[model samples]
Target: MTGIVNDAGNAATYAYDASGNISSVARGNAAVSILGFSPGSGAVGSNVTISGCGFSATPSQNTVQINGAAGTVISASSTQLVVQVPAAATNGPISVTSPSGSATSSASFAVTQSSAPLIGGFSPTIGTPGTAVSVSGSNFQTTVNENSLVFNTRTALLSAATATSLTTAVPTFSTSGRLAVTTPFGQTTSSQDFYVPPGAHVVSDVAVTGRMAIGSSQTVSLTTAGKIGLILFDGTAGQRVGLQTTSSSFGSCGTGSLQILGPGGSSLGSTALCNGNYLTAVTLPTTATYTILVAPIGTMTGSVTFTLYDVPADAAATIVPGGSAVTLTTTTPGQSEVLTFSGTSTQRVSLTLSEDSGLGSDCTYISIANPDGTFLVPSTLLCSRNYYSNVLTLPATGTYTIKLRPYGTNKGSGTFTLYNVARRRDGDDCPWWPRDHADHHGSRAGRVSDLQWICGPARKPHHESGQHSLVLLVDFEARRYGPLSLRGLWEQYIRRATDLASDWHIYHPPCALR
Candidate 1:
């Protein structure tokens, strides 16, 4: 204020001090006005400025309000002022306040959520042709449409829609395999193949009787006479009798008579001798009883004599005390020998017989104490009457005697006879009677011994108390070598097993054998 004053116009003034410093000064006051106020389209925060108001201004008496709400100003000057933009103050008009007044401007900000909806996978991917498939995706809308989901090569309708996924019903398509899916923003496909998965030949009946039988033929079938062949064996080779048919005064009708035709079709023995059902003769070939039909002949009608007898050379057989007699060396039909024995105590004894004639009649019958005839051994002893013959074990050591009983009285004669007897070091006689504990099929305790004879009949039943009169039938028609058709053998095994089970309380295999 201590200076020389210089006055020019009335609106201006200036002054100079004695030390050459200008001391008089004057300020020009201007009214505060927000001429230019703008915000970014998506701008947030309260950073506002009102330029051209004054120079070098500061936030001394200036403040701001975001969205009309009071807020602290960060920086204030003549040109700009900045304040914190509250989170809730987005997308609204912002205001600033100076000493002169307040100014407002339009503003907008982008809004964002915490997260976006998402989906994972679908269950039970397989379905019928026209089934609804569940879709899984992200950012889904409730307004489902064709653009929401898609099916590969199949027409689909969006039946359901949600924020997380949609369900689309599939349409009928002629094709098969994996399917694909798509949406507005992305696409996905199935990794599996769909398909429809595919649905045995089943003998109906069988019948049989005698040598001739009827049944369902297998892969191969035969229908001729010579197509059938027949051979005889005494557990070894075929005998010497040619097969022939006759049509004379004594000729056989239908299938003709079965004669033992020699080399020239001439009857070897008398043709009349071989014309009956069960033959009983003292003189004939051991093979006279074996007349098996070679092929499946449907049904049989005619009959032939099966003669069986005991030759005189087999008499006076060696007998073992308390057991059966020692067999002879003659294999002939109807050829039985007698034995004489004298003893006491009745300890168990056994005998072995040689099957000379395989006519199915090489059995032994003991006349022990008159009408008290039991099988020389259990029928199991006669397992196979072939080359390696059978051994029979007897029970009790006593004065007993027996006779070599031929099977059919016409077949077990001539050639082979009984050898010596031996004992089965392992078990006792087959428990068919008094002793009643053993019942399993594999139990060998009461099998066969060497002193008894399992003659005549097959699979003899075990009896309990008193001595019973037993009659056995020799089965010589079974094959002993190679493969056996055994068509009816199961029925026979069942029959035998049932008999043994009832008599001895044993459980055998079922009625069928493989």
Candidate 2:
């Protein structure tokens, strides 16, 4: 046996000689002392080990900081630590801080630069919190502990790893940011980001006027002044909802956008769309049926018909680039299909949309919107049930929304496909980049490109179709980004991972990160 930690969180470390016999076992030590670390030096994302005493048993409580950056502790014990170096780390003294005390190695750890890890694709892009997310990439650390898995800024629990792939779960407080894996070789982040919405499911469709109630839908027109379409839906005390109103004529509200009244005829909140049509949300204060007052905005007039949408802020879906075409179906006249993809400002993208043939002409209408429920591309009504998008430049960095609705009460079905688009530059977000040691935030660091991410320096070419890639067949969302309180969620991840230990494992040193 190499080493074992007792139930008291006290660990005994052992070193064996070539003869298969124990050489040294340090026990009963309390002071934090560094026996020294191996390889002596490595790159920014390099993984390393430090032998010592008086380290905390809870791995998350151990802080291994090299220079000014804090390393991620994969596993630890009272006598040793296994950590992946931080991207911001540099040549400096290795300091280990635990709940028990602090220890500094006498020797300084060296930080060198190397080829960074690169991402090719990821699977099951849409998920709620705690969902397992698998990433396909290159130059990743072979050993799981040697690589750091992070979503936004929260460090995810590393489940497995290889040279080209890694597995982790959506951290509790996960919102937005590309899947970033830091390794001894370097660091690489995905071109696309991940999202975690609250939850979403189709409630109902209101084609013909019906009673205003939960799961019941209604369609109304605001052609004349004071024309209002009202709806009443039961809401839980803390439920939040997003309402989307679609129509053959989808336009902005000039004077007033829309009104949402709570129980007892009280105004809860109001949502307005800037350019394109979207449903903003409001939190319900009590469990009761609430009224949705849809009135004309600005100078909107005529028998202009619009669809109603009550999207409860949490549910969403995703599309795999260069994968199979997704079939969208609408059983009711007022229903619409919504799809999303990650994008950055100035990034160009392409798409193909076609309605199921033989359904007659002029049945489908499509539109692309910004992350804030505004217009990126305005609505386009297809006359032949076929639409091909132009090379379009994205205006911001976030999840872009795509909406498909049947025009003018014409119920229809269709297929939509988005080609793979990755934006990068030399020594930027692309693979094999050996210069920058910091995280590659795509929006600010690179030029827009739709080129394939091969295992070499990125090159430019007219974007092609059907690129060979692992297809993700599940739904995903661009986790909306905002100020998140991480203390509660972050602790859950760390404690959950810490429980996986046998309550007595001691890591050994002299292992190289690569």
Candidate 3:
């Protein structure tokens, strides 16, 4: 505190709070000492040097600031640091900071704004996602986020900056254009164009294509054969949408060559209208703009009517085992309805999908999507209609979706019900169901309905655990099984352990199962 040094050894200065008390993120190591800085005043984007002791040789490790605005360190040594005056820097004292500590200059460092930033060049003109590109500029905000850099329209991540330089990477899904930098004053672009390959940018960010919602219709004219007319719609992944078209030349039925292109310009789904109308459904892969390209089948010119609609699915409706039945309806043969149920990994659930109209499989096509949106069962309209009853042990503990598609050419409704009571497929439906084995007291075990448990609320009870297995026991031999009381069950367990010539130890159970 008594040294002649008025600057930080790392090339920054101690910061003062509102009350003039010093406040800084830097903690000075006793080894750090700042002597002074040369050319104490400089304009924004200009460089100055500080003479110090115990500074870092690594440039980035040494932090320098003009007043409160942080500057980027371009070079450093154990005793000297060269730093640029940051954009947004005003007239104030300069400071230097490192891992050791911070020290302020006794005199103020003047910050002058001579002009807006200028981009001279960026090395290696090929702009691709993740490629490191360094930009030469002037009057740039030295703080990383302060300088807004973009490769074409896509914003690049700013890695480093100084008064006359910027370092960043070409952003993913970026278009080809000159490197552009924007500061508080204004924006500037490089003279040379950075070559980012075309098409990649269109594929990743097709967000705002049209203002059309479900049930809206639009018309576009196809003048000649093979002429593609594109309509844009914004959609997200895991969504299913339907497309239908009508033209006077093609009749009232959906007739036209329509193809869907994803944001990345990849084909999602397409259908060609020959002598008949065409309709199809699609599930999107990512959130972006999807293009519906309409083309005439022949050399006929007409205004085509196109309608976009959502596939009906109630994803919010959840049901419990033996809960109220849910009715799924569809107007088209290929349409499907989605319903969900929450289940655990250890649970075995049963589902029944029936048609009271005696159509059975003719009215229902049932498949499932797991918690992660992967298909558990891929149900199709082309599949044979049969009674859909599945008893399966769930894969994970989350909401499992059931896709109930209406099968056959005739569309109607189907009743769906879910049940938690299911037998294990390994042939041991109820492994814990007590067997009426003759004990020393000749007690007969009574049976209850499927998997009726008297335990937990969230976790599954271990069948082998003594305390859990006790709850599964009924009053088969009421008095012989120790009156079914908690204490009586303990005594019966001890007596039975001796009778069965087995060692049954009492263990504490969580006693909670979903």
- The number of the candidate with the highest TM-score is 3
- Which of the predicted structures, 1 or 3, would earn the higher TM-score when compared with the native? 3
Q: Candidate 2, residues 8-33: lDDT per residue as tens digits? A: 64556566688988787776444565
* Candidate 3 local distance difference test against the native: 0.59
Write down the RMSD of all candidates, one decimal each.
Answer: 35.0, 32.0, 18.9
Candidate closest to the true structure, highest lDDT: 3
The lDDT, on a scale of 0 to 1, for candidate 1 is: 0.36
- Model 3 lDDT tens row, 1-514: 2133325423334555779776753434446666567676777677888876767889888888787889889889977899888878998887778886776766677775566789988886664477788898688977877789976456888878999999888787664445678986678977666654334332222211232555577776655544445566667778877766543455533445666766444567665533223345677776555667655554545566666767654333566765677876666434656688887887876565655343344534567778998866677442332233334677888988887654433356666667565442343322333333322232333332122223222334443343333322222222112111132244454455435222222232222221
lDDT of each candidate versus the true structure: 0.36, 0.57, 0.59
Query: Against the hidden reference, what TM-scores do the models get?
Result: 0.22, 0.27, 0.43
Winner on lDDT between 2 and 3 is 3
Q: Model 2 segments beyond 4 Å from truth?
A: 1-261, 264-286, 291-316, 331-334, 344-346, 357-365, 371-374, 381-384, 395-398, 406-412, 420-514
Question: Which consecutive 10 residues in model 3 have the weakest lDDT in total?
Answer: 476-485
Q: Candidate 3: deviation at residue 136, Å?
A: 20
